[model samples]
Target: MARKRLLLAALAGVCVWGQAVPDSPGPAVGARVPGFDLADQTGQSRNLHSLFGPKGLMLVFFRSADW
Candidate 1:
């Protein structure tokens, strides 16, 4: 009985860890995205609110500069 309980606990831990967490979020099937803040090309600060101001925004992520 003790060995059975231990095996069940180990299996439960493995199952939990195997579950996936999304690397990206939002727009599951064409949804409006929320505003966010980030930096600009020239080292200047930028934000979605400032760019949109009363409009909407879109974002695309890519790999560059070893990032």
Candidate 2:
């Protein structure tokens, strides 16, 4: 029964994960990202401008199922 409940909970989570909230919709594709300054893992300050490439920067986000 515990295993079954976990499976159902996981399914319910997946069902709502892709529903986007209109007001808080994040940066759209092909849209320019606003300037931001943050510390990198190496403890150095970095901004979007510093990371620019010949084409452009592509940010990736990895969401763990455990969340």
Candidate 3:
């Protein structure tokens, strides 16, 4: 039982360490992002500035796909 508890504790520590932590207050409100590039669903390169229109752009982030 003690060995099982120790293993579980170690596993928990590993899981916590594997997670990501933000280093700074990334992109404050109303702050202009210095521009970035990412691939679209069609696998084409897209730029942040190009996406903005007269109405501007709305960025949405999903924490997990399981939800």
- Which portions of model 3 miss their true places by more than 4 Å? 1-25, 64-67
Query: What tens-digit string does per-residue lDDT give for candidate 2 at 1-67?
Result: 9767866766676677855435324775467767889887799999889988999777765576477
Question: What does the lDDT read for residue 64 in candidate 2?
Answer: 62
- What is the model-wide C-alpha lDDT for candidate 1? 0.65
- Residue pairs clashing in model 3 are none
TM-score of each: 0.38, 0.50, 0.50
Which segments of candidate 2 are over 4 A away from where they belong?
A: 1-24, 63-67
What is the Å distance of residue 41 in model 2 from its true position? Answer: 0.6
Which model scores highest in lDDT? 3
TM-score for predicted model 1 compared with the true structure:
0.38
lDDT of each model, Cα atoms only? 0.65, 0.72, 0.75
| Rank ordering of all candidates by lDDT, starting from the highest | 3, 2, 1
For residue 55, model 2's alpha carbon misses the true position, in angstroms, by: 1.0
Two-way lDDT contest, 1 vs 2, winner: 2
Worst 10 residues of 1 by lDDT: 20-29
How accurate locally is residue 10 in candidate 1, as Cα lDDT from 0 to 100? 67
